[model samples]
Every structure is written in C-alpha cells, then in structure tokens.
Target: MKQQTKTSKNPWVWIPTLYFAEGIPYVIVMTVSVIMYKRFGLSNTDIALYTSWLYLPWVIKPFWSPFVDILKTKRWWIVLMQLFIGAGLAGIALTLPTPFYFKASLAFFWLLAFSSATHDIAADGFYMLALDDSQQSFFVGIRSTFYRLAMITGQGLLIILAGALEIMTGSDPMYVNVTTSPTEQVDYNFENIPEDLSNIDELTFVVYPKNVTINTNKISTDSLSSLKEFAREHNTKNGFIALSETEKLKKNRLDGGETWWSHNISTPLANAIVKNFGVKKEVITKTTDDKVGNAKLVAVRLNKQPEEDKEIVLNTGFAKGDKSISIGSGERLVFNSMNWNVPAYILVQLDPKLEGVTSASFKGISGNIPLAWSITFFIMAGFFILIFVYHRFVLPRPASDHGSAANSPSDILHEFGITFVSFFKKRGIFIAILFMLLYRLGEALLVKLSSPFLLDIKEFGGLGLTTGEVGFVYGTVGVISLTVGGILGGIAVNKKGLKYWLWPMVLAITLPNLAYLYLSTYMPESMILINTAVALEQFGYGFGFTAYMMYMIYFSEGKHKTAHYAICTGFMALGMMLPGMVAGWIQELIGYQHFFILVILCAIPTFLVIPFLKVDPDFGKKDK
Candidate 1:
C-alpha cells in the first residue's frame, strides 16, 4: 500500500520533456554546431579544432559532478541550469552578427556546453530521486524515445529549415553587359576564316563576361571572399563557361557577319551575349536593350603588344579613319572605357601574327549564406525560450537534503584528487583505460569528416549532397538505424552476456567503415546509394557501441561505483575529442578517398586492444 501510494503520480509529465531538454543542448553544441560552422565558411581545420574544444566541459565533467551532488538539491540544479542554457543560447544568437562573431559565439557555446554537462549530472541524479525502481524501469524506453525525437528535431528539422531559409535569402544572379568600342574596321586583316577555332592562325581580341558578384551584405563579404580563395586553392572553382563547341559554331553560322568571328570567342561570353543581348545578326547594331543593362568596356586587345608599342590614343573616336584604333599586323589594337552605349558590337580584329587568343569565364553570383545562418541562431533562441517557460511552470520540484560535503576550497581540491587517485588504483586499470581510449578511435575521425565530405562539390572528390539531402540521409535515416541497432544490441548482450558478444561487437563497429571508403572512391551521385551507405555505417556504430557501454559498467564495480562510471565516461569523451581535433587537418591534407582508407587502418588499434581487456561471462545477463 505504501509503495503504491508513493508512485501515484503520472511519470509522463516530466520524463519526456526532461530527456528532450537534455538532448537539445547536446545536439546543438556537438552536431548542429559542426554543420553550422561548415556553412559559415570556416576551414575544416578550424571547425574541428574549436568545436572539439567544446567537448572539454564534458571530458572534465566528472570533476564537477561531486559539486552538483553536494551543493544543492538535484531539482534546483536542473531548473537553474535550464535557465542558464537558455540564456547562453540567446547570447549565441545575439553574437552571431557581430564583427567578432567567431570568437564571441564560441564563448557562448562554451557556456552552453558547461551548463549542459552540469545539467546532465543533475538530470540523471534527479531521475533516481524522483521515481521508485519500478517507475524508473517502465519510463526508460519512453525517455529514450523522446531523446531520439529531440535528435531528429535538432539534426533534421532544424537543418532542413535552415537550408530552405538559405534559398529564401539567396541573391539573384547579377547581369553585367560587356561591350567593345571600336565597331568600325581596324588595321589588322585575316582572309582565312577557319571553320574550326582550333585552326585559327592567331586567336586575338577576346571579349568575355565575368560575373563580378559584390556581396552588399556587410557581415558575410569577408568570409565569402576567404571561402572563394580556399575554393580556388582546392581547384573546385565551378567549371568554366556553360556552352558547347557545337552550340558556339551553330550560333556563329546563323549570325553571319563581322560578329560571326565572335563564335570563336569563349563560350561563356558568347552565350551571355546571345541569351542576354539577343543579337539576331552577327553585327549588334542599334538593337533594343532588351535584357542588356549598363555596359562597361573594361578592355579590348587586337593581340599581345610589346610594352613600347602598346598605345592608348583615346583622344579620337572610331570615326572613319581614327589613329586611336590602331590594328596593325604586328601592332595590337587596345581600348579601355567605363561607359555604356546603345546597340553594342563586340568587334574582334584578329591578326594572323597573334595566336588568336580569346577567352572569358563566368561564375554564378555567390549568395549571403550567413543571413540564413543568423536567422537559424535566432530560431534556436526562440526554441530555448519555449523550453524555459514550460520547465519553469510544469516541472515538479522534488524536495531533498542540500549540504556541502567540502566546507573549504582546499577540501574541494582534496576530494577531486582523491577521486582521481582511486580510479587509477583499481586492478587492470591501465589496460581498461587503454581499451576505452582505443575502442572508438576510427569512429571519432570518421564522424568529424562525414558532413564535410557530403557537402563538398563533386569535382573536389566529395558526394556534393545538398544540406537538406544530408540532413535527411544522415539525420533521419542514419539516426533511425542507429537507434534500432542499439535496441537490438542491448537484447543480444542481455541474452548471452558481454564476454560472448565482445568480439562480434568489435567487428560490427569497425568493418562497416568500408562503406565510407567505397562511397569516397566511387563518388556516387544517386541519393539512394548514398543513403544506403550512410545507414549501414550508422547502424554498425549503434550496435557496436553497446559493448563499449557494457564494458564501462563491468569495470565500474566497487565502493565508489557512481564516481568510477563518471570517470570512465570522461575517458570516452577524451577518445572522441583528441582524434576529432586532427581529423580535419588530415582530411584536408590527403583528401577524402585516402583519408577514409586511413580510417579503416585505424581499426587495428581497436581490435588489438580488445583481446587484452577482461569481461565477465555473466556481466550483462539477468539471473533467472
């Protein structure tokens, strides 16, 4: 009767929201932040480096768990930390648009990371305090389900929304008209107009349109420029013009005149004139502006002229026989102007002496992606706001004893030292620590680079998946498989015990990495193929991770069982952080294909350490 009375209240009210809150900040700080930084134009090295530092709060959290236990009631810590996390999120949104946004926002993320880690300690402790053993067991799956839902919201819906918003904020393509001033006949002569441009004696006098995208947004211009430079360095500058040789030749034949030679010009510039200016005849004389706006005659050249021979007699116009337009056999005609004129003609005076040099390139206008990113921050801030309000009113505040275990600063330091020393003193402690560190070495490197490889352009040896596609494939499909695998792993370990399943779990975790290697090698464009591959890798990770958790539980047996488990988790976090910090730099150096091959090689350490580690035959089994 007494036990039934104690558990009379419904468990549904708080468990779902409690676990959901716990998951949001973690996903935000860890996974969402990685994607956000990539879209913000940070180098992979910087993204991996700084974001890895955010894990410090979790790595050293064991040192602070004792403080949460002794200093206040668990309910107090949970509520207070939620509010703190909420404020930190708002701060991130506020700092995103500032000049020092990277440094400023990282500082706020640090605050959120620390608060979230402390909240984990409080939330777990409170779970034990608030419910009886039966109630706790019944609600475990419910809490897990809600937690995964939060992961979907953070990783899937949020990312998809941001991607959609990016399209909304995208700048329209800017059009600039390019024209040549010297429309009249020049001094140079070429009687043999070769059908094939490759046969041209001296390909001279080229006029092509280059898209000069000037980002009017003050906040993102610098980052975009840096990204452009990085892209150029990596050789992913979006491939040259969008015209085929046949199209150019067909247009030249249809036009038929002085401007017919324009077909031999670069594809991008010629295509733009045809599409934008709508020049029906080869000569563009007195045609309506149509889509053509103000023109800039930036430069014109008959051919490469010697420094001494190069002349700019701009005082005279192209009226009949002007000395300003000098098109000699050896002398290259040159002109420069920043003015617009009606019915602009792109006249090319080809000299047989020159090698027929004509080329121009066009690039799409780069958009302000940060505008969308900044809006994402604000949206997250609002999400935290709703969480704060709900938790403030609805969450039950359980009563408990609040006492300070350490009265002074020295006492606190001494407690921390003792806690560290006790873990190190356990039997087989060194080997156990090595097993924990090496178990997921390959996974740590692979997770950090996964998003980057997906987002990179196909030309750069990446999958070139869009943000929404990546969100769906990895966040929706991959996470679903991971959860299913974890559930099955638990059932398998419970039936046969950890010792029997240890080696199989290790293989499950390490072998699926080959999927990533294959994807990078083939560079598959089909979404179905990419999603299938990602799902395989994630399912393996989820299933294999169960053994790692079971080992920690097995090793944490003793007088200070809870404290030992916390210490074990710290080592797990360290394993992820250390390798992740350098993963990006390595990927950047060797590229994705070789980098994944290297990831497969890292599996050796994982397998090598497993044989030496001890596990109890009946560790995870229930006594019937």
Candidate 2:
C-alpha cells in the first residue's frame, strides 16, 4: 500500500522532468547562489570571485565527460548525480546556521556544481540513446523549453519565495519620511546641532527637522565648510563588513589552498586591470566655488539592548518620489548590544539640480538573513530528494545505457585525451578560443555585479530594490524579454545569415549596457523604470547573444563536432570567469555609475576582434 508497482516509461513522462531537473541544479549553482550569497551577508568582491570559480566545473566538464561513458550507464549516472545534488543541497542547508557558514556552504556548492556538470553530460547522452532520431529532433525543443522553465523556477519563483520568507521571519518593516526644500536650510551654527542620544535606551530613528532645506545654487564658504567637517568627523561605520570582520577575511583569504593563489596572484592582476582600465582617480584642484550637493544628518539608535547573539542589519533606501533627494552615506547599518544606545548618523544630500520642494520617504528593513536563506535551501533540498526518488522510478531504461566496452579506466582517459588534443589542434584554434573568451567581456563584468547593484542601498548607488522586486526584474521580465529577443534574432538570422547579422547582434548585446549606465547615473526610484531598463538590456543581450551561439555552432562544425562544441562552451565559461572575478573588486573601487561606464567601454574589444571572425553567408539561413 505504501508504494506503487510501476511508473510510466513514456518519453513524455521523463524527458521534460529529467531536463528540468538538470537545469535546476545548473541555475542554482550558476545564478541563484549569487543572489543567495548577497542575502547571506557576503561582500560582493567575495561573492563574485568565489562564485566565478564555480564555473570551473562547467569549464572543465568537457575534460571529464567521456569518463561518464566508462564509469556507469548514463541512466545510472543520472539517478546517482541527482542523489548527489540532493546531498549537496542538504549540506548547504545544514551548514548555513553554523559559524563558518560561508566556507562550508561554498564547499557544498562545489559538490552541487560538479554533480550538476556530470548530470548535464549524462542527461544529454541519455536523450540520444533513449529516443529515435526523429523523436530526438521532436523533443530537442521540448527539452530546451523545460530547461528554461527550470531556470525561471530556480531564479524567479524560488527567489520570490525566499524574499517572502525573509519578511515573514523578520520584524515589521520601518519607514522614515524626509523632505527637501530649497528655502528651508539654516546657516552653520552651534544652535542647530541636536542633543546626544547615546545615554538613552530605546530603539528608534532620530530624524531631526522633518523638513530639510538646502541651497542648491550656492552656499556661504563657512557654512559649507562646517557641514563638511561634521560629516567627515561623524561618518558611520560600514554596515556590511566591520573592521574586525574585514581583517578576518583578509587573514582567511590569504591563509592557504586556492585562496592563497587568489590573494597573491589573481587579486593583484585584477587590481591592475581595474587601475589601468577603470575610472580615473580624482584630481583635486583649488577652486573659489563649492560642491553643488549639500548634506544633512539623520540618526538611528537602539532604545534597549538587543540579544547578544542577534545582529540587527538594517538596509535603507529611497521608497519613492524625487530621485534628486537621496541618502549620500549610511545606507547600510548594523546595531547590537554593544552599540545599542549610540546614535549612527545617515548623511542626506540633495542633487545640485534638485529645484523647488519635494518629498521622499526612506525605508529600512531589518531581516533575519541566515534563517531566511537556511529555510530556502532546506526546502530546495527536500524538493531535490523527491526529484531523486521520482527519477529513480520514472526514467526509462534505454538499451544503449551502459558502461564503455573497454574495461580499463586508462582506456577512457586515453580517449578523453585524444578528444582534448583534437579540439586544441583544430585549424585557427587560437582565434576561435580568443573569440569565445572575448565575445562577452562586458556582460561578464556586468553579470557578477548586477545582483549586488540591485540589492544595495540607494546611498551606495544601487536601485534599492527588494529581493522579490529584483527577482521580478531579472528572473521574470528579463527572461521573458530575452526569449522574445532570441526568437526574433533567430528569425532574422534565418532570413539572412550569421555573417549578415554579426555586427547587429554584437551591437544589440553591447549597446544595452547603457541602460545600466543610465539607471546608475540617475538612480531612479520607480520600480517600473528599473524594470524597463533591465528588460531593455536583457533583450539586447538575448538578441546579440544569437551571434555568439551561432558562431559556436559554426566553429564546432568539423569532425568531433559534438565534443568540440562542448570544448567551445568551456572556453566561453572561461571568458566569463576571468572578467567576472574582477568585476566586483572594480565596482567597489568605482561606484556603479563609473563601473557601468567602463562596461560600455569594454565593447571596444568586441568590435576590434570582429573583422577576424569569418562565417559563411548562408550559415544560419533557412536556404542552407
């Protein structure tokens, strides 16, 4: 009564589900983990550098793929890898509450990444063996559709679910309303200063002068000088990384293993890249004029001591209204028993062009980050367990699903070595590798930093979007628009050819970088505006990306095409990884605005390499 006798062996019953399962772990390892790390309290630099390395599994998956043939039946590998994936998810969930959660969870993610990469190899192999040639063609699109659905589920629905849980598990959100008027500023004076609230025992925001006025045009030298001095003197400590935590990070990062190499070698190289190619350092000049933006102070303090074990992390940003009025600093804040009563100041500033009277509310939410993410991963783990069980029974037993005829592991390695050598020895292989690596340089730089940009507070130059809002922007709308763009791009390429569409596709991908540049420069408060910007950028990326994919298919057309294509993907991932590792480090040095500007500049390399690429006139054309 507890178990059913048999499950259906129909391709309908398994192809979609198997591919869906395959996509889930890939998306989780590649994209979802970046968002999870952000919500879990990792600095962007660490998140990008570490997660980009996760690509190592996929980058080298081609190297080990043939081994999947010798080790076990593709069916066996599929079921076993699903089980391993479930174990990885469970491991992450379990370690999330521990003191060294970051390191421990990353280890589990590696397990997930490796298992998923193997699963990709096995699942794709099984598809061919299980179905007839005609059936394979019929289900190819179906498998891709389900795979994409898996991406949306992992990125969109899963993220929204986590965000909701974060709210449900935390305290009621707090909102602080502030206003700026051109006529309401007071001159520099001791009388305007507020009382010290350090002795008071209470948890509340101490927003002084609900209506703040400043001179947008010009201000007296003495008054400007006084406010600047005060802001410098009372600067709030960073909310995300404390001095102690930062030192610990440096120590841990440099201690040993791969990190030792990263700290000494990769870190310096990345810094060098940033220094040479990133935004120029500021050069101060003597001037009779003053800074156009004016600043004011707002404070937050705890009324009572918090529980010793709990750390309250408060992230603040503009809720709505004029974008010109913004928090210049103190976007992220942390308070605990040790600093319960002392007031932390947030510096507010007005854009020099902000004219007339306008009002805006800055909202802050303090959530229990670890618990929220812990629950998310635990649920995923449980879901994977169910998937493992279902696949164990449901997947069809194909005739071709068997280990290699050769008995020796050495034989398998030898064949793999041949495939690798053949791939490397292809004509114009160097050019092909360079094209794969450089094609998406700008996107590589942008992808690793986008989540951090969306999630960071307004004071730090992010859009101040919530997790759900961000999920909606990228996971939902971005994906949908991307699909449409890809479909359109395919149609256009089919009508003409890859050679004809190459420049347009490249432009489509590279030009939309300006959307991000515009958003960061203006820092708009509207969610709709943010969504539109992201959609435009993603759509362009999807359209332009058609060329990159076509080029890969084109390049992989010779003997050992399938294996060569896999190697091409490895090179593609390497391209993304190298640029991504440095993205966050550079973004932190320069703000988002300049970071995006540099991203736009990266397109020059893409264009520079274009003349070297050769594609047949009829490559993607239907007539071919």
Measured by lDDT, the strongest candidate is 2
Report how far off residue 295 is in candidate 2 (Å). 4.8
- lDDT (Cα, tens digit) per residue for candidate 2, span 1-624: 112113336788888889999999988888889998887656677888999999899899887887788777898999999999999999998987666888999999999999999999999998888877887889988998898888788879888988887777665566666665666656434244455545655444444444455555544445444654465345434333232222343455576534667678865665675566544543222235654556676656554666765567677777777767777666777776677556666666776556777777777777767778788888988988998899898887776678876677687667678877988887777777878988899999999988789987764567777888877887898888887888899889999999999999999999999999999978787778888998999899989999999999998997788889999999998999888987776777566888898899999988988888777888999989
Clashing pairs in 2: 201-303, 202-302, 202-303, 203-303
Cα-based lDDT for every prediction: 0.66, 0.78
Give TM-scores for every candidate, taking all chains together and pairing residue i with residue i.
0.70, 0.85
Writing each residue's lDDT as its tens digit, candidate 1 over 493-602 gives 99999998999999989899999999997877667888899999999999999999999989998878899999999999999999999877666545678778888899
Q: After superposition, how far is residue 148 of candidate 1 from its true place, in Å?
A: 1.1
TM-score, candidate number 2: 0.85
Local lDDT at 43 for model 2: 69
Clashing pairs in 1: 202-354, 202-355, 202-356, 203-355, 203-356, 203-357, 204-356, 204-357
